[model samples]
Target chain A: MMLRQGALALAALALTAPGMAQDAVRSPDQIVAAAPARDWVTIAPQDLLVMTLAPDAEGNPRKVVIQLIGAPFSQGWVDNIRTLARDHYWDGMAILRVQDNYVAQWGQPDPGMGIAEKPVPEGLKRMSDADYTAGSPNWLTSSTLRATKEPQVIGDWPAPMLTDPYGDYATFREGWPIAGIQQMHIARQWPVHCYGMVGVGRGNPPDTGDGSQLYAVIGHAPRHLDRNLAVVGRVVEGIEHLSSLPRGKGPASYYADPAKRVPILSVRIAADLPESERPHLQYLSTESESFARYADARANRRDPFFVASAGGADICNIPVPIRAVAAE
Target chain B: MMLRQGALALAALALTAPGMAQDAVRSPDQIVAAAPARDWVTIAPQDLLVMTLAPDAEGNPRKVVIQLIGAPFSQGWVDNIRTLARDHYWDGMAILRVQDNYVAQWGQPDPGMGIAEKPVPEGLKRMSDADYTAGSPNWLTSSTLRATKEPQVIGDWPAPMLTDPYGDYATFREGWPIAGIQQMHIARQWPVHCYGMVGVGRGNPPDTGDGSQLYAVIGHAPRHLDRNLAVVGRVVEGIEHLSSLPRGKGPASYYADPAKRVPILSVRIAADLPESERPHLQYLSTESESFARYADARANRRDPFFVASAGGADICNIPVPIRAVAAE
Candidate 1:
């Protein structure tokens, strides 16, 4: 229905902030103030990947979860992912590469273990940084790979589609930056990639990323990847792990040693596992009233802890929160 | 004697770059290339923090080392830090806060539980982001903290420090765009706060960060803290452990539930430990001849890997390396 009516109809139903429904960018605080319960949706357990790491020498597991739901993530291979993340699967994994201000990647069981004998040229892992130059207003572009979507004008009319909004300035709907939750009126759609966002780690060499090797955005929101990479989920829990790999020693942070790789015991899709084995999960609905309040607190940060309000917020800077749902 | 005679000698050195030998903006590569052997100091193991996380439920003892040197982290605290790091003395610690685009920090073990807390206020905590923006660049005065230095003569006298070198063509030193390094050299030294940089985490009031709680920068370096905070060290490894923490549900990433604190087993000074216990250590000496070749390679990127060279470098973008050395 949203696709049929187009953006104009949906604009009226769209939210500018969490619960505030006035829908003006200028009045972010007021918009969430009026949102209804119809805005939020409960995330399905099947859509979740609760990542629990085995205890380090201290016997404390660094536990964090990811909610993977987009297209490719849900497409069949998720079961293998569950196995990979479960039971010390990534133990002694190798940190394949770490490109500065770009990514710090960790690969499965071993990367150098099965060498083809020849140093087959590592395929190009392209970054938008290659195309963009400082002081130039032009958008970054590349001929290498189309990882992000481009604006298209179809039949002389600008056409937009609905997508899951994770990063950038996604206004809250049901506690997630959801698309298509409102009255089916808007035709516009774009995906945002902000910090703490997670995308499947893939290799240009083909099928290199089985989702076992993953990464999180730690610096600025490398937003250009929204349409390009299969963003399976967001790091609902721990993201800092991928962000700080001590900047790597070699060209990329390809740690030269076998022992340097951070091990991943396993990754499990919540829905495939038994109830007792599942991770406790809960996320405030972006479309709900409570969530609007949360986004508000994060947007301007009017709390006593803040000495001054930043006044304006870039959608990337705003916080999207998730928590472990406790057993009743 | 060096400080007094250095002025005249620098006048002669200035002839190399912009008319002042001492006034040149030397890149890290250039700085290391030209620096005398005395300018580089071997990091004493006693000053290093051999941080080892206790075995998690799976029993992987994730071992890492952190070093605190220069000011604040001094020889006096050697014994104290040794106990804190090597012996599992300060285990099961708490993460103090997760500052956006900046840092994620963890505090020391509880006092009654057996560890002594560092009483200093968190280094470089913020009062407002505006201080970084339009508010008042001059508000730097009146504070007890000293200002960092950047020296360059505009028309034969030093000009104002420009943070952006390539974007702004800031002053040059030994062929590098420089500021704070010089400031610190003149005894007006301030901390260098960039990614993976470490500082103590503190409470409501700034300056409350003691050695007990530690933080590592996961995002853009918060340069605002250069002089305001006592930067203890930089993360040699395992910064992902800090950056990837599920952002605390509350503001500043303070996890609302105490149970969520990612535990820290201990933080120690590396130098105090026995040599046999050290991770075979080495670093791409910034001052080494090989680094000069590497920096040029980076500056021009003539390698087959890069089709086009960036032709420029950012201070924060430069990679400072640390390595595990194997004895010949």
Candidate 2:
């Protein structure tokens, strides 16, 4: 038995050798490397958020790029956030909380800390708890939406898709994992709280969120927050900056000392920035064949180093691939 | 229709109000707080690993407490590691790797860097690849074992259990989750790789691991490594010391600069330390009713703040609870 196991292991290793003729199973890396340019979708400048932070110790400004969820999904919140950036509402605001294995949030220390109170903008309505889900009437218009009652097979294993009894099926759409339920003939969807996904912060009442305060999940997927909180978007680049910050010390891991807070130098919409300063970011379209292959490869990795495939993958496990195009 | 949606949202919130008559689901925090003393298992000093690092910039020594997976599972690796610690083989050895969203590993830069290589100890035999599993003949001796093919119900939802067509069903055993398959009347089980779980790093071919190099999973649960690597234990406390380190720059995130490497002050078995210096640590027993309740609460949280429970939870979502005991 021992000899047989050893021989099997050796045979597996040989399949990965450079000169071997047999083609090994395509790993996620291999699948991604072979993808065509057309399989990638460029981010619309109007949907991009560029947040610049106070200089690091070495005097280099730290920047985080966020890609907002498209129309019919938290569009009101996204528009409000973009307006806030245009008005410089987030300038000088500090990242006040960095709870370990949770989130990093930033906003004014007080609601009116640095800016004067102003009338609520037109079309920027207070999002109620009902608006926090895809089941809402506003999200029923997307034609590409679909619902699944069973786990989707990716690669050779069943993907870790969940059928929530309380809501619509949780699945992926357009490179973003969304949770939604079907009402009548339409499917309503909201973005999930996966790592690096950004959400709007609020007080006791659900409708208080107005895009003034925002947070990004920095650790494990806090999926319970879905349908409860407004997940406005996801960080496309520079998540390491947010995740690597020193953990706060106060309740909910708020920075106890004022000096430790990381400050926001400026916040700008990609379209509003000078062409030279704007980032040319692109993401793997969920509809692309390469994406399907990539998702399957990730769900059941067949890399040489891995002895056994997990045969399953959770929604959070599949991070959408993004890359920055060099400015011409 | 909008009004009805609003009414339903309001009704959901009402269920969580303090005065509601229905028994609110017990949260994981509540279950843990209400646990009886018998539900807690004291750690044997001999099985405790105390790793002390050079003082941080603030002049306080960085200490990490690790709890070894008990007998018959990776015992050979454990014994060899303990012997290495006793010989001070790790003293001055640097933490060479800190891969972002992955692992932090530490040991000598090369074999025999700080200490001379010696003959393998009498009891510390080379563990074969087959020993990396619970289904092996050696692990079949444990009596407190059980196997399940169905998803375990944790709280109101089914736990995210995987049925690996290639190997065994992945589920929990004691507080530790395991991958096991039943043969005839007996079940075979082995420890799983979850966040904060420690593993023995080795070279090509499985038998080469002698426990000299060790790493802790500091990011996503790499379940694909299940039967591939030898996982010896987990970090019970001070994981922030490992997770918060600066990521290395070299391939696989190895520290490229020697000056940036964090140095190990000492590695000692708790039993070898003075009684006053030993950690008074205990973990919630997997066999305890409190543990079951805690697992359920984690899977489908009923906390007042959570608006909707994720009807399922992956293995990495359920962290084994541990606490330090006050000196008698």
Candidate 3:
């Protein structure tokens, strides 16, 4: 069994070897050798939601993805709410509920006003008993879980896309894990909750109103949310800010006193900004050498103090580190 | 059967009437009535630790609790962590780790240098993993599990403390609908993973390290932590903050880059401060009238909107609201 596990692990890693070899360090060309520019498409400004709140931890707005209303969205009518986020669209809203553990929502608290918050007025009103609604109409690709796969998926993340046995236990991709459980069929995809992933907040009334208020997944990754909630986007950076706010003193996190509500100064889509004004950025290539190295550093974590190498890692624990892309 | 459920619920409510009347509303005795004066105790400054980070959502230096070596401490840690807080120290620190349907943790990520950035070297360590390490050398609480429980631990929070109505269903805590085989004689008391609960985080060694990185029961409230970890506090106030942090990137949340780590400014015990420096905090005594209303609000949740209230509130979902004390 051990040998088989090992061999299977190695077999899975072979897929990413070519990609890792050419570019492994943290540089502008990190994944340039491995991916075509087509892989770097920018998200549409309307499709992206930039949620801003008074500075808490990272000193930036709490951002999320706002996929368009589509077929996947179970609450049928909501699709008509043509969203245009940048111009103070979802600010100064009321929190519908703060479902402890699952989400802390804020937006149009009342159903009457909730529907009004959407651009297309009478979208959809979910039943009180509905489970979850989908976000976008994008069809998932066959190999979205991993540009490649690995031996086993301890959890949802690919184990090690690229590996250097003597060095790191990973098979490189665009700096993301690509190993494990490829056969299990991860192609069935949706936005799985992780810290900072955003979802439209709803209640017993799943479609009573297409979500106008939103909540960020701030705790453990709520995998069950996959194919369920309309997950718009994730916080590429500055999650610490949102995850440390003072909780609501009222029902469903609608602070008993409005004074407790955090304020929003502004929210903007990164892509909407002028080319010279966007924040410096670069996401680690899921398939890269620096990524593998970083993973190794984390897997073993021998920072002059940690005595043992846990040799294991949770997928949610492995966030694809984003950085300020260097100036040419 | 329905009638019985209503009766039991009413009886449970009748049990908490006296405590609410004690709050004068006007004078409130300043400190005593703010929170249960008897329950209000000091935390040792030696045990205090603070964490400072701008989480994923906002860009602000967020502060949190982190304990050092000497703090699995029973009491007397700081002069007053939140001096203006009512309920005395009851509102000091709050819970942070509510994983969606999992364990909720509470502790400061950083308190002080030694306390903040640790696995502390100074505090007491459980001598061994033996089940008998008692809080006091008195009667040791033996931790065990029920042989058959189902859905069992809906993601880790303890099985709700429930009772059967009409003996048809095996109602349990966590406000879940359950059907199970009973073994009354085998009932054991373990610290349940209810929402807003506080727990300690240990290294793989289990007992090594100080309480620097604190978390809360933001998710489903993992019941497994009960009896396994030391639960020190709860989210008497804000919880949305911790649950909102973007998931950490890397192994078990040890950021791949040390710079990604949130810093700890300081942590002081609530008791260390002078009496005059305490916060005027108030809590709807879990055993009070407001509590009964709060509990009912959760149990039935007949909000004008809830088409269905699930009719059950999990132990953790029942928000234990906290507030600032109104001085006379």
Candidate 4:
């Protein structure tokens, strides 16, 4: 709650200075609380995946909600996943692996025996190596547009930033953390593999992922997976349900006994559900001025609890704030 | 199991090269399995903290094992902690906090109410800010001695390495990850705050910590706490028991309901226990050549599962392998 309060205060500041003379630096909670309603973007129901897990022996069904990244950002993977979910592809699928401090993956028990790959839907594109990079002119144009606006400053460091050799720049676009390399005219960007970020699991071949098997990061951000995996989106709500799963004990943290697996009840697009049953979720808009301050505060916490500021923050360490809107 | 296999293969490699042509790299399991008995250091019983947690509703007691760092490495804090446990100071203390993606702290519900501070034991010293740095000539001498040993090579990078701006070098001494600066004729080092690393929680004053409240990093490594906190040791075994606890929902992740708190059944020093009851444990020695290779392999994984090796690894990502020794 202190962190939440801090997050709100930070989100409220429009221009955060490293050591500016002020009564006190606003916390992220205060900043977010002071944000205008327009600064909160409602997640489209169609882009939301509501996964209801079968009740355990105790009879409590676990529900997890995911907010898919919008179009042109892992669009192919997202579309393919949405198609698979809509077709009831994962209704009976089980959470196969829950590696401690790693990932919790859900898919068919035997990949080859169950859930044969289906033809790629008409409009959904097959993801490839090129999909990993945002080298297209469109991304550069957007980055340029973002640069025209105020650049976020964390401590004394300005962002769209870079922690090089690791990545060229760490920036945000459409509410996703992007690690990018800026060349002469084009920028190559890809979604970072932060904790709670969801990705499609596949075999040795990069293109083999069809979204039938997916995993959510449950540990320290495995940034090496960046560009190597198709991170479709992030777990916006009910991440606790996913993170709290019993860690699997077999190879790659697969459940040794089939009976130990947690069964998936169903995964439905929020839009397909009745209006009354749909989740009204809103995320702090990355494009908003408030978010810039929020990100900075997270990078360099100036709170009383912190003795020294980290001076810089890793891309994965910064969590995007999300909340479910109350039903009218 | 696959990760273990990979670790084994990586560990078995006699000498790791960044991108050198080799038949294959050894996994940690293999390296450890093939190690000489002498390579495996039996944990001194005196330094082992055996924590028996109160039984769950089903009456299943959860046990956690912590191996305290040896003398001269948070010696004062560790000594204080040992004395407290010896006095049965935390017999009925409840685990007051279980912060999701942060830490699980166990101590008195009210800092001032339950366990009053005890007088310092005759031989145990109180820790201060000076203990935070390895600036002492003894440390510099040892660091100088360590510098003489061949530095570990991971890919093209060398260790005692530095992640930059954060620290001058990332090295290990006595099985603990250390972030240090190799200055002229002296080195300033401190144990890094990596996952599963245990630390003493204290008040606002830097010197206030006396090991009454202790916590383990349960999620991402909060590296900012490196020098600021007194890191006593690491959770050597049964960490899953700690990591899987129900997260508290109150401010700072404290359990909202007092009933929800898990009680500490008892804490015993292994050395004080009957010989038959003492835990049989061994840890891979950090000083060995095998560890150099192990550390390097972890930094740049050559496993088949990983397509691209993170050219460099952060200090936190490298986990020191530990195991329960087979009973004689």
Candidate 5:
């Protein structure tokens, strides 16, 4: 995943104008490739949750890497996730559901089928529904806030402000996609359910499941679930391992057959793993100049394959670039 | 997928207000269940493309049913698809690429490998860049046209009009999702790239693809691809067969090893099949009152599990409900 310097230099020379020869227009990937190394931020090992699934039929290892949401957004559930990983709570749990164009859910469900439910680790944070969104206390003075009170505002804020269907405005915060609504002087923000985002599964209201069960969005961005669920993190790698599983036949896509469930071999935080086995990953900083350009290029695709550049882009469409950092 | 009257009646009584008890607020699925049969429209057999992929490891039949685009949108490509299907152009072709969180492409690629490429049937239509979007000559007289000069406007047209990132407005047209920009006295519209949407794959500009190689959006709604690619149809059933395929290792997720490619057993128009073999399907009419209510429910989740309701929704989020009709 290392950026090729040769491709970067060539793309820079080619990025002059749209409607030029096919090879002249720099693609969004090319724009990201030309980004300076300083714009790349390394993810802390403590924030990485690595879950290992049972080997596939061919005996290939199956591992999924998740990047926990940072402070000021769903951190309570994030803390619980880290604790669960530390306690090996999900070590022997199974993937319970694979809903087509919906989600791939894992971990324990409510007990009924002969199997005894495992007791949750003590001191797991019990978060209220209000915890789903964080209060943006400093937004009144922020220069990034658009002045319009309209339902959707389109302008530059790293990228063109989205005509958000879920909130007044949707944008990136600390390399994470977020949507926020301003009510008078108060503003509340929540993580959105873009594809590959990992969320905590719960049963009914007043019962935000304590991160014992989690699921990854495997299809289109289900924005309806935004303020309804606790999005603890996002699957940074190995999503294919889950997304490609056979969909369940039971109602809500739960596996009807007991043997159909895929088992979780282990779950561990990267910091707990040996240094040699830890994953080295970096994400393009949302605040960096390169990300702004990258986001713009995504909104306006001047790439060779594209005949017309879409004048705008959905917030989810402009995914913050993440890449595996090769060891020196 | 049948409407259960018991659940329908129960949900009807529960549809009072937001923040009510969990059981009282009806979910979007329940609203669709309550939709009258008259509100459901039967898809024409000719519009259905039945693609049979090679059986899986367990020998389970993998049949993907695609509903081709109707009149006034990508019809040229749609006609070509019908011709290709009738001619059995994809019988021995293999899935070309499967880029995770992007697309699952299938068809014959340009010859470079040892295998000779299949000769495309004659009478394949050559399309222009202008055909990517259809002129909305009747838009000014349409009752659904919301009058607003703002970048984004939120109001009910079946559902709340989307704050489209790709265009001035995004809405549903005859059961299909679309976006368009108002340019002075003219408006041009194009089919959007939602999850499961199929598009014609082309090389450079003016190629517009000859309806030979095709791809299905297997991830988030890649709105950036709108107006950039010729959208011909959407996979209405068995998308998991394609979406769950292992990612290809080659550039653009193409299969590096030709052996890994899944072969297409056959591709045919559903009308070409025997009456007993044809799949019967119906989609909720986007213009129906039930559809409007369903779209509203999707935008605002008043269900018990939801503490807060998202005031609006992406057009793709409100998927037109399609269900199989049991054989009589």
Candidate 6:
């Protein structure tokens, strides 16, 4: 049993092999592959965090790349994360918890484990719960915010807005998935919790996390966490390293045995790495024509394997495609 | 870093431990634990599929339990699955593909593997593509189907309907999450592809799978497959065994090295096992008041950890609670 990618395009093109379809009506992967280099947006090195974990059981190196969210959303926590990375604060930390169908969190081990808590670096921002969401930036014009129906035209591009149950509307902005609502002639938007989205883990009321502790969504998108926690960024690559980790047996999936923790070797900002060691990556611009077609194709599958197309897709279903920059 | 379940109720009750909340405004987990025995419905052994995989590298037993969908949805494929299980057709099969953020499929190995395909047992039903969906059952009344807004009342009970992007409406019916639409005064509905939901896998068009091949959703809800493939059941337990398996490197995440495939020891219907070996499981009835409150709590988290509650939840986010029946 197989759900081969680009099956529809292959059949339509009468090709025996996968990924050979070149026509206009192509698979999502094909569309992304055919996207012009001009449509790719290179992520800034300062915005990238390279986390190196201890070798797996087979002694294979494991690295997870996280792209920090830019301005207009959770910048306070994002900045704190950068500070922590720069300070090497998480160097000796370990993955402490992995909840099934939930999250895999890493930070200081629980005090119950008899481990001393490491002090966080100075110069971290103190963010309030209100910082969880932001006033819709200028890019989200008033007209777009006021549109009552979906497929609203945002800026110069006609974004394929989704009908969401979590918010008034769900759409993409600045290469990120966001949900928003119009309130008193103002728009309030927040980065959503899609699979692989990174978030700050905090204690109870009045304590928005300081970013010393972080977690990645490893299962279904836990939308309930949106607006409840500060979404800092998303894992751009190597999520399998965390998602496949053995789940903790303790409450909330915390590792009950201190010895079982997977050690974090180091966390470094891409800019801090040597010039020759930096990893170059780019994402399909959300505003590009290729992305529009890709989003539409995700919602409506014209591939041969599909007997019926889902007329629409949820925000998390249309993940932005990211890839390593090809060597020039 | 933690998302402690029932945090709100614990704080409200001034309890220092989890699961101590007795009040109505408790967490979703608390609500399920407090549900009365009558609100829990036992799943018949005949409908349970016990799949035993080879011991893990650590020699740990790995068993996955699946609950088959009952009447009014994919019953033809469901029956075929039962026949295969009774005939031990998949005893020696191996898990073939595990695509990240997609599915884990197992069936006959690729012809390129040089392994002979086992002929399917006789008397297996040949289902058509039309069986991918079914006419709304008698239980789904016309009034419920025609509701134009959220939280429609079905029968005497009010089901918390969700605003869905893929269908006209999404809600729970007979303890299963479903999406449906009303057309020409007739209702058509099908099971959804939520994480852990199992489905029959087929090749290209007109060859609707005969249940010889099967796959399980291991990531986010791949709703695009809804009405395109046949959803037969869900993994009620031990999904981590599959979700944590090493992802394949071959195209479509098929294991390129045939030696890497995890062997399936056996598949058996719980009813076919010895009486003492049968698993006793129960699920919170979707029609019960406890479920109504749980669903509401899921959509709106009054939990102390949450600063802003999501006003609503998608169908997949509100998974039906299933647990083993304690020995009396």
- After superposition, the stretches of candidate 3 with alpha carbons farther than 4 Å from their true spots are A1-48, A54-82, A86-88, A91-102, A112-187, A205-211, A265-267, A289-300, A326-328, B1-328
Tens-digit lDDT string for candidate 3 (B226-319)? 4345444554433444555444444444333444443333334434545554334444444333444444444443434444332333333344
TM-score of chain B of each: 0.60, 0.81, 0.53, 0.82, 0.87, 0.88
Assess each prediction's global lDDT (C-alpha) against the native.
0.43, 0.68, 0.38, 0.68, 0.78, 0.79
Which residue runs does candidate 4 get wrong by more than 4 Å?
Answer: A1-25, A36-38, A55-61, A111-126, A136-165, A181-187, B1-39, B55-61, B111-126, B136-160, B181-187
TM-score of 6: 0.90
CAPRI tier for the interface of model 4: incorrect
- In candidate 6 the C-alpha lDDT for residue B102 amounts to 83
TM-score of 4: 0.81
Q: Candidate 6: deviation at residue B49, Å?
A: 0.2
Per-residue lDDT of model 1, residues A1-328, tens digit only: 1111231233433333332332323233343344343543445777777665545444756655677644322232344455554544554444455554566555443345442222212332333321111121122122111111111111211111121112111232223332111212212222344566665565543244455556666675554344334344577765555554445565445656545555556556677668887766555455444544444444334333333332223344445545555544
lDDT of 2 by residue, A1-328 (tens): 1111222233221112122222247777777677799988899898889999888765856899999988567877887998888887888778888876679899745453344445544556577777776554443322112212123422221222332322334556666777665555555667888889999998867788889889998776776688778988999987767876777877678887777789898989999999999999998876666766676566566666666555445566677788888865
DockQ scores for all the models shown? 0.07, 0.22, 0.09, 0.20, 0.40, 0.37
What does candidate 5's lDDT look like per residue over A1-328, in tens digits?
0011121232222222232243247787887788899999999999999999999988999999999999898888999988999999999888999998899999867567445699889999999888889986444322223322111222333333444657766778888998887655567888999999999999886555889889999999998899789998899989999998889998889989878888899999999999998988999998776776676677667776777777556778888899999854
Regions of candidate 6 where Cα sits further than 4 Å from its true position? A1-24, A137-158, B1-24, B137-158
Q: B145, model 1: CA deviation in Å? A: 25
- Model 3 residue B233 CA deviation (Å) reads 8.7
Q: Docking quality tier of candidate 6?
A: acceptable
True contacts kept of each: 0.11, 0.17, 0.13, 0.16, 0.69, 0.61
How far is B149's C-alpha from truth in model 1 (Å)?
Answer: 25
Q: lDDT for model 3, on a 0 to 1 scale? A: 0.38
B155-266: candidate 2 lDDT, tens digit per residue: 2212224323223344455557666644555555678777889999887677878888899987666666777788889988777788777778776788776666888989
Model 5 CA deviation exceeding 4 Å by range = A1-24, A140-160, B1-24, B138-160
